[model samples]
Target: MFISDAMAQAAGAAGGENVLMQFLPFILIIAVFYFLMIRPQQKRVKEHKNMVAALRRGDNVITSGGIVAKVSKVIDDNEIELEIASGVKVKVIKSTISTVVGKPAPANDTADKK
Candidate 1:
């Protein structure tokens, strides 16, 4: 007798959210992760692959182990000969190279561009 019947009916009439609205935050999080993290990582891998493929004799490179050396020979698809010092060459796996420091000057270009 003390409680109103309308209040009980109003409580029962409330509805749950739609399925899409329930999952919207998860979808937004995945989209942000792809754009902010995954995409840039893919781009860096592509760039590193290109740089590794373009390696040739006489290009100075820094290895992943932090050794600075000149590429003396490209042995095959997977290896290169690096000259760490005069007459001190070592065979290094191509993927171990971290960065190409600089390309050597062309052999045929004798005239100074000054």
Candidate 2:
């Protein structure tokens, strides 16, 4: 008896449009994050996969665990032998390695043994 039915219907339609506009900024922010942040991280992971697969023996490397060791032996497609110390070696998986250290120098016999 107090409010008109036609006015109430018009107000409901306008409120729905306002609600959708309020959510537009949030959707745009999520799209920006996916392209700028998430996509680059995924690409980096794929490149790291290729790098690990190409590793070979004699390539000095540092592990993700922060242990720097030379590639003493490549055991298989997934495992490798790391020489952390003289006569002290350890087995590490390919994915564990992070960076390749400087390459070893070529051996040259210049000095005479005493």
Candidate 3:
């Protein structure tokens, strides 16, 4: 007398949504993150790698530690010699160079202007 057969039939009729519909919001959130965050970060990393690869002797640079110097020599793939003052040089890791300050005067252009 307490349990009704009509109530049991109604409960069975109400089913949940499909599995894909339940996970659609999560998938959209991940896509948003990739476009807004991860993609741009990867691009910046590529640009920094290209800039570091283009390093050459005589280019003025600033290190990550805020020291200003000129690239006196590129020691190897991962190291460089910086000339901070006249006859004062220090060896630093290439990645420690934060920015290329000013490029050296091009020899051919200077000679032509003279």
Question: Which candidate number would show the highest TM-score if scored against the true structure?
Answer: 1
lDDT by residue for model 1 (1-114), tens: 436688888677666656678789999999999999999999999999999999999999999999999999999999999999999999999999999999998866557553
**Cα-based lDDT for every prediction:** 0.93, 0.88, 0.91
| TM-score order of candidates, top first | 1, 3, 2
TM values, all candidates: 0.82, 0.72, 0.79
lDDT of 2 by residue, 3-30 (tens): 6888887777777779889999999999
- List CA RMSD, all candidates: 3.7, 4.7, 3.3
lDDT of 3: 0.91
Error of 1 at 5 (Å): 10
In candidate 2 the C-alpha lDDT for residue 45 amounts to 95
Better of 1 and 2 by lDDT: 1
Using lDDT as the yardstick, the better of models 1 and 3 is: 1
Clashing pairs in 3: none
Better model by TM-score, 1 or 3?
1
Q: Extract clashing residue pairs from model 2.
A: none
Candidate 1 lDDT score at position 10: 69
2 versus 3: better lDDT goes to: 3
